[model samples]
Target chain A: MEKDHKPSSTEKPVLQKVAKLFLYTFLIVIAVVQVLPLVWLFLFSLKNNQEVFNLPPLALPQDPQWGNYARVWTEGNIGQYFFNSVYITASAVILTVIFASFVTFAITRMKWKLSSLVLGMFMVGLMIPVHSTLIPLFNFFLNVNLMDHPLAIILTYTAFNMPITIMILLGFYYTLPRDIEEAAIMDGCSVHRLFFQITLPMTAPVVATTAIINMIYNWNEYVFVNTFISSDKFKTLTVGIQNFIGQYQTDWGAIGATLMISILPILIAFFILSNRIVEGITAGSIKG
Target chain B: MNKVMSDKKVIALYVLPAFLLLMLLVYIPIVLTGYYGLMKWDGIGSMEFIGLENYRNLIVDSAFWRSARHSLLLAIFSVISLIGYLLVSLVLSGRIKGADLFRKVYLIPMLLSSVAIAQLWMRIYHPTNGVMNRLLTSIGIEQPPLWLADTNIVLYSIFIPIIWQYAGFYILIYYAALRNVPNELVESARIDGASPWQIGYKIKLPLIAGVIKVTIVLAVVGSLKYFDLIWVMTQGGPNGASEVIASYMYKQAFTTYNFGYGSAVGFFLLILCLIITYIIRKLTATKEEVQY
Candidate 1:
């Protein structure tokens, strides 16, 4: 094979070099495509409507209308919405991670006859379309007098996120060495203590991963909040921004600022926890 | 250890909270959705038993059928787009520098809420001022297309942002799967005189077939239930041109207060998703997945 290809060996390196360059260019172009819209969004957020219309789309803001952010932050209920998003997301994440951890511990560590069936139920929960449950859930909330309540939003978020949260935890739990857990049990560590102290600490990395994943989901969730919560006081940013943007439909800078505010927390979180985010998402999806 | 581990009371205590939540919120709601489809009731009013009238009407509901078709088109588009993602992942996984940074950049959109993405894309598709038309007009086109309007093109237009939002996600998944292809196999294939394309197509592609199948299911089922972006952007508007199944169901139930009929559509979507998922799983089921 070497003898047959000897004549073209020099040409091969040049061909490979050109191919590699093309591949790099393709990758870079996609990266630009992904990031450019966001940069454009940021630029328009600072420009007045006049500048937004007259200037080139990518041009920087002339005066940098910082007041756009201020107005949206204050004039509207964006601050309220932001706070609502924060606490609701935090509550849901805590509930989901703890509940998922408890269930995962029981299914994986504690011996039980119906363990696989229960685990199967959680796994199947992943595929159930949230839309299918919306109407009934609406009626359920209303009938029980929980409609338009933040608890409805929080509990729904917890329920829907349980499957993926447990999934991310399950892999880590399974791989946890049994020696420590066994010793703890032998020394008469109560089941609750064994789980809370011995197992939970060991799974903290995955717990953090699952926690972030839940936070992102609960933070970005829209359908439940839109359907369940009616009043402005209980609304999250995703739903709050809908009505907020409606009133300011023509105000490009304000609209941009509102969108920026809505997404900034997740963006900041992503920048800080991207590795775990990536790991969690990969673990969550691939196993399915 | 066995005595402690098999503690029935402890097991029930640990599992029941989540288990019951799943039952009430998920499983029970689903059963109720199907049951609700059988009754005639406004969301807040007393129900009158109508049997399967809603389902029968849905069989011939042109608008619902149109939305279902649109969803099918989106599903098809999503599955095809996976090929492009796979190709990009193949290139990225080919020992490229900055692959990590490139993938993370792509994933930024995926992290964002669909509502925000929809609002931003709506501005991007603004008839006169959007960057899309600006680029088109700058290139000397006389009249740029109204992207989210014009029923003929609205569905496809909405698909572009959907692609943008999810491209990174699929790429990341594919990149991970492609990277998991054992290096020794690639090296052996290279030493045996295989070209890069051949190695990628023959070795890497076949090895990652399981991941590819899973993604096909995800893209299709996900497309079928797509709501947020379309809901926020077009609201299945311009005379329902861009309406998908979930959006249509939402409009019926929420917008028109046709709870019974909406529940029927919702039930149909649930069944459709499950059936399609099962069929895809069976179709893609291999004798055995290739183990590294």
Candidate 2:
């Protein structure tokens, strides 16, 4: 197989060009299809039912009624829901990162049989679908009287997400050289000081990356939130949009309106920190 | 003594706190699911011993079969769709400036909440005012089929968004794999008069088989646990045409109040996962571990 640079006798220039053109065309068409829904979502959010259904449905809203958006936020309690979403998602990311980082630190730096055993338990969680064990989890929470509470959903989300967090972080942790850690000991550094000073600073990119990934997951997570948070008081934006559908069936105008509102916070967060999110996730996955 | 805790055993204590939490939350739930699967509790009532009844019911349950069938279909379709998207993405990964731009646009959907995506696509697929139908009508095609309403088409319609949300993931994975292929192999193929397809199949693809294996395993798991988008889109609707095992479990637990049966569904799902994992490990274990 290892030969000199000799052109394949069978290859043709026309066929090569044909293949490249075909692939490029295919990719472009799919890219358009991917973007089309978001475009339509934007359009429908603005138009009333009549215009929405009008022939050759307008690509751009005729009048551009911004009031639907205002109504979506106000009537649906989306503001409160969004606030609740951010609070839960942010806190979950923080707590999970802390718990995951500590485990990664100990597992990677400290050699013990339990490191792998603990990691194995976390991996078991990875394979267990939430539905299978949801009731037991529900009963456990109910026994602790945590139903209809944000704390309940947050804790559940944190527990479910920990496996992935640790898995991804372990990849990063294993890549680091242990020399600095060993050096820290010669200088009388304690575990706490060594982590904060030597390890933590170097782990910046991954921590940022995990934060973005975990935040996206927690923010958009629905199943646990929907099941645990039956009350109007504890709903997040995704659940809120869902409940909006239940209450206002076939009300496409309001439905479209609420859906648009639901994505704004994510859009804001992603756009503001776009650089961080993209780099972080790619780094984690590529390294994995 | 206030000295260094360098004993290797100290690592166990450090990992204990996190290990206990994972046990309480994760391993415990799994064990409880297996235990509850054997009972006749309606989630709230006292547990009654009903050994093998739930499993027996599972065998003859049409709904369970439907859901299991849906899981199989999802796994098959998702893997196939991923392959198609990847083939297209691989061709466009490099040799084009727009690949990164397309990559970004394709990935925008990933950041979106599934419910939001469901709502967005639901409007796009709405019977009368849908963009899909309107585009069809503009080109003089009359009454394009209802995407979500038609039972036969509804499952595929739901898959459209799923493919869009996930294709970017595979694209990135394959692109990374593509980058690892030595340019000399590709250049040498070209110089030897090999077409892109020939070069891709003979060289690039064989080299990247490991990544594809991981991707397929992921696709399998994703298909099984798929809930959010389809639930939001169709809710296994039009007379349960789109239900997966996970959703069926949800329906039993939440809608029908059959907690024990729901737990049994979970046990089945766990077993399914284990079987798949075992198969994948066995398949890969005999081969060399290709680093790239």
Candidate 3:
């Protein structure tokens, strides 16, 4: 191989250096491509329609209209939507993480007869497309008088996210040492106490990962909220931003601001907890 | 411990809430989707038994078939794009600088809502003022194409953003899998006078074949059922050039109130996803995987 490539060693180093530079340049270009649009979005969010249309995509506004954010917040239902998104996302995440933890604990720690069957059902739930369940769910919610209600959206998010949530938790739970459970049960700790006190606390790190995953899904979920919750008051930011954009279709700045507002929470969460997000996403998908 | 673990009442108490929600919401609705495909209902009206009429119409429904074909195209595109993602991952997983930062930077788009992504891409593809045409015109090209409005190119336009959104995810997965490839194997191959290309091709690729198979299933199924970006951006428009199955079903049931036919489309999507998933898994399942 060396004879076949009988080039000067110094020349080989130079060649490799050029290749390395090209590779880095390629990677950096993709990174910029990924980030540039959002940066453009932010730039345009501070510019009026004239500025947006006249100026370059990457240009800064002459006077940054911080007012776009305030205007959208004050005029549109954005504030209400933001509130709704927060509480609903928080509620769904809490419920999903808790419910998923309970089920995962039961499946992993318990010696139930039909554990595998029940677990299989939940696992199968992972593959069932949300679109297939849409019409029936809408009809079911309407029949039960839960349609157009926040609870419908909340409960649906919980149900749909349950499979993946449990899937993430299951890996964590399986690795949990049974000795702690044995010690607790040997001390006569009730099963509920065991789960809530020892097991749940022990699984807190994964619970947080699953919770973040669920939060992202619930926060960014569109179809369920769009279909089930028709009323403005019940809509979360993801759906509400649609209405916001529709109404302000001509106002480039307002639309940009609305989008920025809608995605800000997730971006903030990512900055704070990217490692967990990365872990959860990788664990959730590859395992599936 | 066994007594506590096997307590049926406790088990039921622990699992029933999540399990029942799955049954009532996810499981039951799927079954009902198939059942509703057999009935004639307008979402508000009483169901009248039609007995596979909807499915039959779906068979001849050229529009629906067109949408299905588009979905298959997206699936193929997604699977093909995996090779690109794998290549990038292979490069990133090597002794590259700032690989961690690059992976995360590439992931920024995946974190945003599809609504935001779609809307942003919509602006980016705007006919006159958008970045795409602007760049083309700046480079001395005349009459840059209208991207999202062109029936011939709308699907590809939408696919670019889809690729952008998911590129990080696939790369991250592949990078992880590649990093897990035993270094000793590569070292031994290197000592045996294999070139770098040969080492990557012959050694690293085979080691991560399992992950690649899983991703193929993911990308295909994911593309087949993709909705948010398409719905938000094109809504299967420009004379239905980019219509995928989910968006078609959505429009039928929600916009047209054709619950029966929509359910048929939805059921078809469900069956297609499941069948493809099962087939891919079976086809990709290795002999060693079975032994385990």
Candidate 4:
């Protein structure tokens, strides 16, 4: 009996090792699948049309053409579009965070008769498809002479992002102990002062999280900018790249370079703030 | 403290700016979208009130139905893919080495804008010089299919990237949820001689049922409203074979200048989303949420 048990135990250990090996391979394969396309994109970006067609798909660029990046930046409106995206994304994220914080503070901290009702309105705003609002917004922007303006894009980003930003902030706000705010108030601090100094400071971690999320959304937003701002000067990278690619449609390296530049900022931000971005995405979605 | 917190003046100052923006932009436009559906107006022209004519045409529009069907197919595909994501999450959440690195690597694609993703994929699907065909030929399959140009498979081809973009997001959510399941419960089940599969399927999944439900709703509604990728990659193209609801609405309003018809379609999409959300919630509502 002891000899039989020993063989079985040894076999079990071997089988478990095999299973573990299989699991790791499975995971690594998925990781490879996810990153390979981007890898190929980066490789192709550094190669000219000849190298791109001649070389293997994953082959390293024999002579990396860094000029592709320079040409796209100088020859196209990519610089202007990049600047527009940066400012638009920054402005919208700032506005969304501030407004969301105020509303969140008011609902979670302040006593209000219609607090729940008001909160419900913003929450339901999440379910309203942006498509439903697109035409009216276009008309509204046209009527108000803001059709081709950057302000139109900024305001729309702020409003559309408000619900999700507030949602992420709400979770953090609810968990915050009101002790310090109450004590500050007991010392005769005003509501505005309490919010600005006490509550807002305490919620900075979540504010950072939501800000990154909003930056991603606003940076990547396509349709509203595509519709409202048709001019090259005001177009964000998403739309700008669309038109830029149209001109350089046959120049694989140039188109690849342009696409890389557009996505690089977000990718850089992701590498730096991945933890916060992950936390933000989980927080924003899991509550649904 | 109560008086300071409840100050009507301060509260109004704090809330009114955001609240008014929400109303002006989101809520008001929704009402206007429905109202605009009752009119005959080419965006820049004077409106002629034509009650329900657009809606009537929408009912008989084969193109709209086809797009709606494509949207539904996408929704189904997204829901089915959730199972694969969940399986991957279950594996990742297990005591695996380098799980964090694996998870983040998977998330890289999700960070990209749809336009960039669409452009990158168009090159991937390029008929003559694409990575896809290159790999196919190297593997000795000479006749690789034209991915986006083929009307028969365009929708399915588009669905692959949609799945790729969202896989990490769903996995991240599930991993977080599965991590939240109490270790003691899992350990106890293991001590009771449960197999690993049983431990995952029987114990972990049931506990994260609520998260699973939310993901289903997200995947479905998100698929129904999926636009940017399809718009960029195919533009509902190969003869409209890949059109989804949002892309179709976009085409009607922005491209074709059929403002009235687009609004009607847009209104229908809004109602469909809300109703589907409500129904999924109702169907998946647990009698009592499992408490640890």
Q: What is the lDDT of residue B264 in candidate 4?
A: 95
Tell me the docking grade of candidate 2: medium
RMSD of 1: 1.7
Who is ahead in lDDT, 2 or 3? 3
What docking grade applies to model 1? medium
> Please, what are the lDDT tens digits per residue for candidate 1 over residues A169-274?
9999988899999998899999999989989999999999999999988889999999999899999999999999999999999999999999999999999999
- Each prediction's whole-model lDDT (CA): 0.93, 0.79, 0.90, 0.92
Global local distance difference test of model 3? 0.90
- Residue A15 lDDT in model 2? 58
Each candidate: chain B TM-score: 0.98, 0.92, 0.97, 0.98
**Which regions of candidate 1 deviate over 4 angstroms?**
A1-8, B290-292
Which pairs clash in the backbone of model 1? none
TM-score of each: 0.98, 0.92, 0.97, 0.98
DockQ scores of the candidates: 0.80, 0.55, 0.74, 0.80
Candidate 1 residue lDDT tens string, B1-292: 8988999999999999999999999999999999999999889889999999999999999999999999999999999999999999999998788899889889999999999999999999999999999889999997999998899999999999999999999999999899899999998887788888999999999999999988999999999999999999999999989999999999889999999889999999999999999999999998777432
Error of 4 at A234 (Å): 0.4
Model 4, A1-288: lDDT tens digits are 111334546677667779989999999999998999999999999999999999998999999999999999989889999999999999999999999999999999989899999999999999899999999999999989999999999999999999999999998998889889888988988887888898899999999999999999999999999999988889999999999998888999999899999999999999899999999999899886
Better of 3 and 4 by lDDT: 4
lDDT of 3 at A278: 90
Per-residue accuracy of model 2 over B1-292 as CA lDDT, tens digit each: 1245445555555666667667777778888998999999887779998999998999999989998998989989987886785686568655776676677666778888888888788777877667787788789999799898898988888888888788877777777678788898888787887866788788888887777777777788779888988888878887898888888898898889898999999899888977886687568653765565
